[model samples]
Target: MLAVLVSLLPLVRVLPGCHCQSTNATAAITATTVTSVVSGSLTSKVGGYAVFDCPVPLEYVTRRSRPLVIRWTKNGHTVFTLSGGSLTTDERYEGRTSIVEPPEFSDAIATSINVSSLRESDTGDYECFATHKNRDLQLTASSQRPPLPSSQPLSHQSSTASTLSAVGTDIVDAGVRIKLDVQGGDIMSIPPINQTRLEHESVHFSCVKEDLESTVQWYKDGVPLDDLPILNGRFNVSLEGSLDIYDAGLNDNGFYLCRIMSAKGTFSAGAFLNVQYKAKIVYSPAEVFLAFGKPGTLDCHFHSNPPLTKIRWEKDGFLFDTYNVPGVYHKLNGSLYFNRVGKEHSGKYTCTPFNDLGTEGPSTPMDLIVQHPPKLIVVPKVLYFRKLGDNITMPCEAENVDNKSPAIVWQKADGKSLFDPRVTVAGGNLTLTGVKSEDRGVYRCVASNIAATISAETELIVEESLFHQKNFGLHINSTKKNIVAYWKRPYSFCTVWSRDTSLKLSNWNATATSSDGKAILWNLNASKEYEIMVSCREEISGESLFSKSILIHPKVAESDQLSLQELNKSTGPVTDSFDIRVERSGGNYNVSWTFTDNSRKDQADVERYQVKWYDAFDGKELGTASTEANKRHIGR
Candidate 1:
């Protein structure tokens, strides 16, 4: 019987914590033989459907005393059961799980169940039970009778035992078991691929899927955005896979991702958010004042994300261009450059910055005031000649005066202010009244305004009046036997004449006049006494001057008839005056004398003279000297 029980057993498979065993009854006869088998393990993605099969042989339930009962259990918990044609399911498996009937062409009476929307908790061992009531059957000698002999009957019995042994090795009569494995689910779609929100606006994003049991998560720029202290009140995510943002700012702009996770799989979707606003003019133009012929610049500053594409410059409410003006241009940093500013460059200027989002308003109008320095129009002469007690004037003029009228004044060449009562300035003209010799210096005319100062100089020369002198003296050369006289005249080209009182009218002599105030009388007779008169008259002014009438006597040469005592005693001529001069020459006294004759002639006969030296403080005669020349050297 044990052999028969072993032979009647069906094939059994080994699983984790699952075993199949069979035992035989001690009774000599049995009523029913049942074999149960389990199908292969089934696997499905999480949030998907899975089916478990239980194979039960039809012969085991045929002709049973009671109807069959089918039950499915997972991990020792009842999942679903069908008894007396009535189906029942566990509370957790309700509506989502169902039992399936076996097909008629299948050899086994099978019980199957489908689990929909599988989750991680549904992955475990599943058991199917098909139970039927047992009935008793008796075997006797008459039941063993057959159409064959007794020996043939034994062979038939052996064949039946072999068939039962094969069933016992492969099948199990306990129950059917099925293993289930749940995998992660997949994400279907995510709405709102990208979002763009203005400042202070709200935005929403959703991650959708078919599986209701899937878990949703949110991320920003690849980082998880959940329960972060920085985004505590700004960001939110719903259970239905929705992300909401409120009062979005520039910091909130970035790449956003929505992730869905389940037992089937993990999936995510990404989007980008961009924030935009209008540009603003951060720095406006300011007023600029520049000097003429100098360079200047004006800047127009602004702030924007896309940057400015163009900048327009305006002057005096009109567009400014380099085509019309030569020294104007634009700088790379959105500034206007004036290479050389002039009077025309003085105006109101504005700058406007433009970008793709349009331009900001024009900058504040800046006043560009150009000022010029003072320039001289009429210059003064370099030199001016004026007589004494005469009036003189120097003219000067200037242009490009500022609001304040230019101050004109005259100054001396020594940089001192001219404060004399004779100096006056009017209308840039410098005049001097009653010019004197003291005014004979360089005089400058200066013009000054708020902008600049300029000056010009002129030199003044004062000349004195001319005059003539009377009572002229004559000079006689006794050695040359000639008489020479010199006189002064008020003008050039004067006539000079001399006449002798003892001579006849035809004896009067006249010579050519001298332009430089000089005259000479030559070749006079010696040893004769006469009264002479000298006179001069200007050629142009007809003014005449005459010297006093005087008697002149000439001296004769010495002869052998005259003795030394006679020569000394004779009153041939007398000197009116004489001059004695002394000079030291290398430890020697050189004495010289010049004498004027009272008779206006030479004393040729007196060839030598005696000079006696005495001490002035005492009446002691120091020495006595004699020399034929007018000069002599006395040695110490």
Candidate 2:
């Protein structure tokens, strides 16, 4: 038994104060020895394996009486163990671990623990211990329990024996520390950073990772920004991996990168820094007044860093569009143009500038006033007739008239101003009361304003009121041999004239001068149409007023017979109670009639009657008049 235990003791270098002893006097134990085959750090990619070797010298294996116990531990935890040539692994490293000692190296006592599929958690300090036991040398009875001094007390003897036993157990246990770093796994990945700051504003950017033990460095535009000479004092990086800028300007804008490096790997992320600026209006249009039918333009000039994306125009409080007015359109440069301006085009205009960032600055409004001439909508009548001591009225109207009430004026054709007490003008109307002959002339109405002046003319005619009688009693008696005519005198002295209308010849003998307004015909024609006219004159002034002409016919009795020459001539029936005569003046003709009942009892009563006139040369009927009275006057 002693020899077998002796052979199992591993050869190892012992510490100076460590000693091994056995309880049996014949059994002797040798000191254990530990050796390392691999040491220091070892790095490998994730999902790979690493081997840690613990080698013992061949001389120690040959001298061993029993197989050594080999153990592998990581960070103070058991990983694998081998005893009596049998391998046992801890539950933590079950399938992915092995302790191998090749058959070729059996005598050498070299062994290794293979850690398969290394992970980040496997990175730590590792150690291996080769332990063996033997029972040969004996501990002297005096060494186990030292004799107490002759004068010392015996009560502390139990404590001394327990101390000796602990010292012996420690001397036999031995181990070696081996360090191998198994690194290579996921590293910290910084997220992208985007920051914006206004001009002259401070900004900060951070690249931090809480899950990794790493240090971060920043770069700008693919260049190191930490020690750049250009950013001497304006920029800095904080201990927590933050880059801060003080009073940033346009020059600080660029792409930035944050790089992180650790024992595992290296990773990088990028960020874009932007310096913003507010939009400003450099120039704006001024107030303008465009004439009618003239073109106009309004411009709004602006400046911005990111450039303007859109621009809009407004009129009054409404948005401006192409349909707002004809010939109006917008330009890309924030300007509005009008091909032709009118009253509807007049308004307040404003331009709004916008960008991707936002709208900035105040807009200036402009006023547009369109000037146009006054247009006449209504005018007075062209001709007006009025009797003496009558009133006359003329009206004129205009659109877009001046603010002043009296923008219209009335004047005569002779350039005589007619604005007087007799003529009142109000609301574009002119009225004249108690009109006389002097007021008979062409008058003009003139409208004037700041834009333009226009005028219209009208004529008025006035006549004296001398004739007052409604009817003239004219009667004619005719027979087969002679004809006579008389009338109730409207004036003191008058003259009578007779004519044959069919022959267009005057009857000189039938014409007479009458003081009592009576006349007789000496020569007469039967079954012939004759017209008689009477004129009444003032003896002093020779002013004359004519009565209506009378149409008469002299006829023979029903039993009368005519010669063959007279029978061949055509004649019309004689009318006894009704007479009609027409006299033409200007474009119109005046017709008058007088009637007296002379029919027999059997004749029908006149329910209605119509007077007709005919053209003398063509014998064509011109017009007809209907009346129920005995006398009528018609003007056509």
Regions of model 1 farther than 4 Å from truth: 1-188, 196-254, 257-269, 276-279, 285-297, 303-310, 316-318, 321-323, 331-349, 355-360, 364-636
lDDT top scorer: 2
lDDT (tens digit, per residue) of candidate 2 on 362-387: 46877776766566678986556578
lDDT of candidate 1 at residue 201, scale 0 to 100: 83
Best by TM-score: 1
The lDDT for every candidate, in the order shown, is 0.55, 0.56
lDDT (tens digit, per residue) of candidate 1 on 1-636: 222232221222111121122344111211122132223333433333444433445444332434666677778988787655466888765545554444445433334455443455566877666665532211111212111111111110111111111122234445555466554424533333456676678887655564778887777767788645556688777766778888876667786766687767775545566655445467664666565776777677776545677787898899988668898888877777889878888889887788776765887888877766567788787555567888988888777454545677777865666787888778888888998867766677787754456788766645341122355553222221334444545555443444455555533344324555553332244344544444454344333444554555654456522543364357443222344555556656677877655533445666786766543224256787888888878776
Task: Give stretches of model 2 more than 4 Å off.
Answer: 1-344, 349-379, 387-390, 396-408, 434-438, 446-456, 464-617, 621-636
TM-score of 1: 0.24
Q: TM-scores across all candidates? A: 0.24, 0.22
Q: Which stretch of 10 consecutive residues in model 2 shows the poorest summed lDDT?
A: 154-163
